[model samples]
Target chain A: MADRSASITSQFTGAGLGRSSLIFWALVGGLALLGGLLGDSYVRHIFILVFIWCIVIASWDLILGYAGIFNYAQLVFFAFGAYGSAMLSIYAGLTPLLAIGAAALVGAGIGVLVAVPSLRLKGEYVALFTFAVHLALPPLIQQGRAIGMGGNTGLLGIPWLNLFGFQVSSIDKLTWYWVSLAFGAVCVYLIYFVILRGRMGLAFIAMRDAETFAQAIGVNEYKYKLLAFVVSAVFTAVAGGIYAHYTSVVTPKVLGTEFFLMAMVMLAIGGMGRFPGAIAGVFTVVIGNELLRSFDDYRLLLLGVAVVVTVIFFPEGVAGAFKPKPPEKAE
Target chain B: MSLENVTIQFGPFRALTDLSFQIERGEILGVAGPNGAGKSTLMNVCTGGLHASRGRVLFNGKDVTGFKRHSRCGLGIAQTFQIPTLLSSVTVGENLLAGQMFGSEARGSAPDIPIQDILYLTQLEDTLNLPASQADLLTRKRIMLGAALATGPEIIFMDEPLGGLNAEEIVEFLQVIRHVREELGITIVMVEHKTRALAEIADRILIINFGEFVMLDRPEVVLNDDHVVEIYLGKKHDA
Candidate 1:
């Protein structure tokens, strides 16, 4: 076996064979073109909603899939951005663009607060700690209604994104879709293309696969853990910022564990570690569920059955199912 | 890399008790003991995995007792696990690539170690693109050692490195260990149970009983010593 492997490697001159990612880039371009033509209707709205969830779930995949930090506070961090932007836009009267920056900061700040202690705890401890925070959040806001966090009712009339002097309101829904699509693209490029493709990404994957081995080889556990949380939180906040402006409302329901589970399910369907998997997952689960909503009460049950079938048939998820394997050495 | 009066405890169980040892530079300091004798514990202490409840660990004239495993790795100490822990999901080359990022310097240092060079050294050059899980025992063991070497450690700890190898495989592995120390000028510390393979290659042997030091001597002397024979070597056992 060793001899066979050696012979195979010797046959291949370029150990790191470079392949053109032109097809992938073209796919993205096509999606952009098609999305642009969806034309300001209810279909565009649904597409925009899918893109927002994809942005959030893609960022979540950074920690949950790549860095292997089973963080449960992903949705909570999204809530942080939504609320932060809502407060800034409604009370402080900041532009949506400026408010997005503040919201990302708020998400990162809360990220640090959650990460500081949980990073020290191994595995399930991190999950439980974050889950406790996730469950604790809505009640805290609901109870703090006096402090003007909007409590159980959530904040309403959060400002819409402004283009020049014109507000991109609900009536002009195309602008909202554009905003969501733009933010999702930037976040995906930053998380998947830049960080996950570079040296830091190698470190994260190494750390994820074998923590003790990674540590023995000099990968700092704390540094990578904190990085995964910070980067994931920052981008997830971008999704939240866009969602807040798009819907023109910020609600406590956004804090639901269902969002985190939804992200996980999307990741599961799309494939765990692949970038396209996140996008595919959001489309398959979110849009598919929307389409199935005509079945009313049976919609969730049918979706549950579908996900289970996906798990059984395509264990690697939808993205994993179609991913091409590297060509094997002949015979 | 050395330990002084190091003691490690797990709950009420004292895993390593007041163990003291000095490792000579550029020597194959082999550790031998029975199962549950705390040989791996001592290695863990030096490797920065388990912290000492008392005493100090010093390397390069500085106390690194408070350092974590990653920091200790930056100090040029690398260890291979007894159970062969590896990044099984990645290719052998990718595993070494990850190791190279932290091979000899601190985190964030540009990886300069050539993949082909380390693979050639570990006799794993051909298996570079193969997933680590698919490698044979010999190749997997070599991969483990290669990954550790990629970190550019001055001293290496091998826990039961010779486990599950045939006589010929054992000889080949010992030759590799010898080349690593003699050619690369790295220090070695290996832990094994009554394996003559470890005894034959080690320059000096450190024996322990019940997590306490028993004797430190040349392998020949230790093999013949009554106490070593009674406690660890057993009466008629000779490798």
Candidate 2:
């Protein structure tokens, strides 16, 4: 209610209120320390998953939560990044590291393609259009067998991330975990600090809350909306690229409804528009997911119930509950 | 700023028909009309809220008929709604800052006038730290004007800015409007129902009736016309 994005951005830059900053650094340090001490490959794999999902969910939050665009094509960018990076690494003979960077460019280009026409459409129409693209992508990719997309089976044997002179193979779980942690940190830093902390973020929140007023005051809605799409897409695609290389597979199933719903749940539970909340959400969900593995098929049903409860009870997500109340006015 | 033979048609009904007018710089023009007289429509056309069915809108001798709303705002045109559309969650200061960041110039440019000066003119200096939603109606209205002034527009089209104000608040708002014009040398086109209030500040009053022009003249000349009286008070006033 007190402008979630604005307050979060202020807390980010306000040296007088460095408490959140301290907490953020502690979280980063804790994750790094845990990765170094943890010996189990299974748990390390889960942490790597968390790191990858954090980038995806945070970028999605930028568009849906902060920009208020209701963009549903987020996973499309992710999928494109995965597929593009896989193709580049395999067929183009680029190293996985360079391919991932190229994949981000591909994602940005796709973002522009989707945003140009979609930004022109009003509210729900943009969502409808983007979702249609999301729905259509798998079938379109499946039809690209000639390009070695592998159709329903997906592209296999994708290369691992090349670090310095060594290939970061799947057997080296510790190396993979550290790389993911560092990559996720850098991506989240760009999103939270570089983009959202500046005037661009102000324009976004203003356009979100009072669009007509923003337009009347000279905020170009199209330009800012396009910016949100492109920036979010760049990070999302990078996350996708990381996920693909880490797992050594690229599949059309990554664009499935379950994954999309999971991302939405992360945003809802993390606190929509609340900075760093999505990170908390990714932790709660991915960990909660692993804990519920014994429930088997009921996992989906339980997740649904949890989301419904979250929406009904904690509409602002985990971040909202922890948000500081606005200060009382001086008499 | 000027409109040449501007007409706005929605389906079969015409909101404005063959309306032509020229507004000189640094003058406050009041627009008055009956309930369906299209005063707001005229304001919308000028602000790019509603595109003209046929005609050209010119600002500073250049045709801007094809410019978008924000582009028009970039060219020093701004407006306020009857109900103040403040960004409810953001603080009052940020609302003004949003305008300054985006209006009349690109991002990172020095504002033509400081936000503090605009706040002083609008008397919203104290509410700077308050969220816009928490402010009262009068304060919200002043924030609206302050934000528009922050844009540093050459002209501001206000659609019924005094609609919900009491007499005292109206006087205060009118004083702020006058100050905005006098100090900043900006042009103002206000669509107001209260002709008497317009008479206090308007350089010229444009009267329209049933989507047609009735008169455009000095406030004293236009307000006292028998035809204008008939349009407002009916045939008995004309007799």
Candidate 3:
């Protein structure tokens, strides 16, 4: 009890310049230095992917882990952001950066639309409904060619991200890497501070752990659930927007089954619902995905083995393993 | 607070049948019933966790039968579960803070009762930072009560607040409940199996069986009622 108390207290109060936070900032700085020093575009590119996916995973964690909502449509929101931003840039004549922000608003709207009906459902049903959305999205996007979605071939030649009059190009991978890093950092902090550390965080956790109790104590479940979806959707779409501009392409592949499965694996290994775990999960999976390029056909098999081993060793994911198991059901 | 002909039906099954009762202001109303007698159901209906299939719930003479649970909470209805349900992920302090922050009319305003007062009343002053999931049953129960009180509720519905405690723990817990009423002046409707504890703390006792009202009166009178006895043990005067 004492140990668990210490950990929770630290989680609540550790926003200051504590040791762990200092170490975290140092690591971020170290990675930035590495990006600057390494002339290898490949390594720098992997770091960029890591940064982008970190936002995705962290946003996913807010709803799935913190709110304990079984929302399977996170990737769909990402796809929406990708497509929405791309269309806004290509057809609507908006800058990539401004398009990303507008796309997030659209994502928030979609989040509200989805959460109002879906979040009222029981757990497994919510998962099924959202998963159905995930399955339905690609075909819908393909059929959306009349609206300049580019259909099967997807949207290409999307403008490069222009920052303050300077075009950030693919050739200057380092600039793209730093831009993504800064973007990811800002998004993660928004999630961490606005939801996880604010009053809503407590409300979300209460709603997750004990719905009836939370409601009876005046924590409006639907309100908080909707808030969770909107916040999650906003950042996830931003990540997707970044992904679109970073790659200069928007494709149906973003909504692929493999991408969803990879996300689940990252959440599993890094510990779903654990703060900072999602970030770790993103790094481990993205870097591991890049590292195992040589394995070819056997790569997925090895990744499966890694998941099994991680589950066996760290039942709570890598982050949870470091913390003590909560005392036997408070009976 | 009052319920008029509240009936809850789960498809073909009726959990509560035309249950009507009035809870006076500033009184501990002890509710007793056999297992599955709809005691908890009655609590649920009053607290807006469940909407009665038929009938009305009037809080302060306002028709709140259709209000959601949190809305009712904002109207000063708070509750503790039979099993001390808490946000296991957060600390005890956080749990109470959740109540004080959102449970009252305070919403974003100042809470009426300070969290420190609730901590001291619940005898959980020392373990404020402790994770609620790791606390013992006694502490959990106290935290549950504290969380309920933190809402600054006008009326609190407690389901089996003292269900699993030993004699000493029960004695200590009963004192807190008394403090809740005497010191805080909050109305309480407690569903408890322990009649003795209820008799000690409650101003009036209401008994039910098989979703039907059995008796409602002072502790001595209701406890001695033949129907209450039959529901508790067996037939009072068996053939």
Best by TM-score: 3
Q: Is the docking of candidate 1 incorrect, acceptable, medium or high quality?
A: acceptable
TM-score of chain B of 2: 0.96
Candidate 1 per-residue C-alpha lDDT over A1-331 given as tens digits, one digit per residue, 9 for 90 to 100:
1231222221122232234235545655676777778864888888888879988888888888889897989988898898888888888999988898999999899888889988879899888999899999999889868878887778888887887788788767667666677777667766776678666777777788888988998888888889889888988887888888888888798977566567777887888776678778998888888889899999878877877888999988887778666556443
Question: What DockQ number belongs to candidate 3?
Answer: 0.50
lDDT value for model 1: 0.81
lDDT per residue as tens, model 3, A185-272: 7788778655687777877888889988888888888888999999999999999999999899888999987999999999998998
Model 3's CAPRI class? medium
Q: Model 3 off-target regions past 4 Å?
A: A1-24, A324-331, B104-108, B236-239
| TM per candidate, chain B | 0.92, 0.96, 0.94
Evaluate residue A212 in candidate 3 and report its C-alpha lDDT on the 0 to 100 scale.
Answer: 83
Displacement of residue B217 (Cα, Å) in model 2 is: 2.2
Query: Model-by-model lDDT, in order?
Result: 0.81, 0.87, 0.86
lDDT tens digits, residues B1-239, model 1? 66889988888999888988899889998998888899888988998888899999999878998889998888788899877767776778777766776654464454344555567678886678787767778888898898888887889999989888888998898999998898678899999773587678989999987899998989988877898878854666578
Q: What is the TM-score of chain B in candidate 1?
A: 0.92
Decreasing lDDT order of the candidates: 2, 3, 1
Tell me the lDDT of model 3 at A236: 93
The fraction of reference interface contacts (C-alpha pairs within 8 A across chains A and B) present in each candidate is 0.52, 0.58, 0.61
What TM-score, over all chains together, does every model reach? 0.92, 0.93, 0.94
Q: What is the Cα-based TM-score of model 2?
A: 0.93
Candidate 1 Cα misplacement greater than 4 A, ranges: A1-22, A323-331, B104-115, B233-239
